[model samples]
Target: MPTNVSNLPPVRRWVPAPVTKEDIDWADLTFVDLAKAKTPEGRAEQVRLARDATHRQGFFYVINHGLDKAIVDRMIDIAALAFDDVSEEEKIRYRARIKETGEYLGYKLPQYWHIANGVKDRIEHYNFPRDVSRREHPNVLRPFLPEVQRIVEFTHRGVLNEVQKLLSLGLELPENTLPDLHPFDETNHSFWRFMLYNPRSQEEEDKTDNVWMKGHADHTSFTAIWSQPVTALQIKDWDGQWRYVRHVENALVVNCGDTTEYLSGGYYKSAVHRVIKPPSDQDGYRRLGLYYFHYMADDVRIAPLLDSPVVQREGVNKFIVGVPPVQETWRKNRASTYGVTQLERAEDGTEYEVVNGVRVTHYN
Candidate 1:
């Protein structure tokens, strides 16, 4: 008989779950309530939880964070309708044109990304940039799930702001420390993504290893994912073991990214995670996900937090330095990672590759 997850211990809170390796213990991920974070004590406690989670696990579930079930459900419904209802030709009408020019602020059809194992990721997605200026782009103005775009845009900004507050609190810096870098101005580099992963047949699932997405980190400062009832999402624990991440009703999953890890001088970590085939029942149906990638403005420089005590003790030598602006990094990273060949080389000819597009590397 297959395992029934619902009968297990509290799925919302941290509880014991069997792991693949005998030496690996189940991770103790926390669920922080943002509503209570209104008070100083509540905020402090939440910050403590966040601090510990980032330092150790780099991912956690959040509750009472302002996004309601209606919003999440509507987003999901709209995403499904867009991908399932809209004809492929219609979607292609808005298909990303800027990728050729080294921009990723539009629609991407399935199979645009390939796994290291030569398997193409079966996903279709539409990306919306937070920068108001990009609103005039043909892809943005084109009618490909307009309502879905609106709701996601509204929800993502609010969530990023709140998460930034929590991050600042956890870092022991002024609440605006991170927010100051991420403004919703015309130069915004943030983006919201609506994604649908096509389902696999039982025969296909059985023959495959089921690693639909390779483990990687987000390149932005923060990433927020709405919880869906799928069991494919897995995160690497401190012990280097991969375990399924549980979905709690009405909770959003948040994870740190490479930019944040750099900013914090390694005090916080960027999680390594991936998606595989879910359990038997879910494997038969399409999986939909909503994601928000938060970033500083194009002009904001990437640098370590000089005032952070954590950085002071750890020493700046261990952290990244002299990084370019956010947009520069974003363009170069996206182009290199996705094989968008247009802007692969800088004018001066430094060879760079975006390892997973979230991590950066350069070679002479």
Candidate 2:
């Protein structure tokens, strides 16, 4: 049986050691300025930063990025408008539906979402993907204001382009690591936008419940997040300390994803994180954030970093080395929340079940 939210242990608080100037490894940091990354030295530095930060903290902040401030503001404006303009009935129109077997659309509730059993996430989010063609089995028509739709498409393509450039640099691959054409087959690539809201209400604030996201790691290649003034994101340091990641205007938070860990052969870390519900009016304010998840193409093989043979050998002994040939691990991770059949639908619209740890997909 799943554990009750209230029964979960309280989050332990630990003071973090202050980050000093000397401790700051400039080599491991990626500033948002791409022009700076254009020169040979600049490109070298960017790759170093990407590799080091992923191996060390699995997260970093980017400033001076090319994303337009105007576009970002407009996106946030649309989010607020959606919350305000869409009637409760209209919002419910997009609520996911289950097919004949009675599985609600994909992962929904915090308590029931894919992940290990834990308390529900305190955050509420709106999900949107970049490209939707009829060819895609899971593609469903979603309601969006015309202006919002335009912005979503523009931002999605622009951000993806930038991400591809960064990936190419870090991987030392050809400029078209992710070609103009889709890198992964339609079945593999995953991209989505998540508009998260952290609202404060008396009922929510006063509840003595542990209804918040528990510590977990993402299942993708990387996540790019941009936020407005509200601050609710925090990172757990290696020393078991929680550091509040203050949202600087126009900055993007970049973090490593599960695929990156696999590709790096475990050289880069896929850090665990959680969302904490802000205290009600803790200084007379609430928080809001927008997150973009960049997933690896489904079929991309993940392998450990080539340089660290010793650690790779150790990892093999520990059963953490080498890329698993199939998506069994990924499927198993989501099964608890999405159920075998529902996860299959979301992945490829086929009925799949794991019998004896083998995923058997049934196609009509």
- Highest lDDT against the true fold, candidate: 1
Task: Point out where model 2 deviates above 4 Å.
Answer: 1-32, 97-122, 132-188, 198-211, 279-286, 303-364
Q: Name the 10 consecutive residues with the lowest summed lDDT in model 2.
A: 16-25
User: Which residue pairs in model 1 clash with each other?
Assistant: none
Task: Go through the candidates in order and give each one's C-alpha lDDT.
Answer: 0.66, 0.47
Q: Write one digit per residue (lDDT tens) for candidate 2, span 303-331.
A: 44344443455363222333354333452
**RMSD (Å) per prediction:** 8.8, 12.5
TM-scores for the candidates: 0.79, 0.65
lDDT of 1 by residue, 62-127 (tens): 888665565566556555555666677767776766545555566687767654334566777877
| CA shift of 320, model 1, Å | 4.1
**Predicted structure with the largest TM-score when compared to the true one:** 1
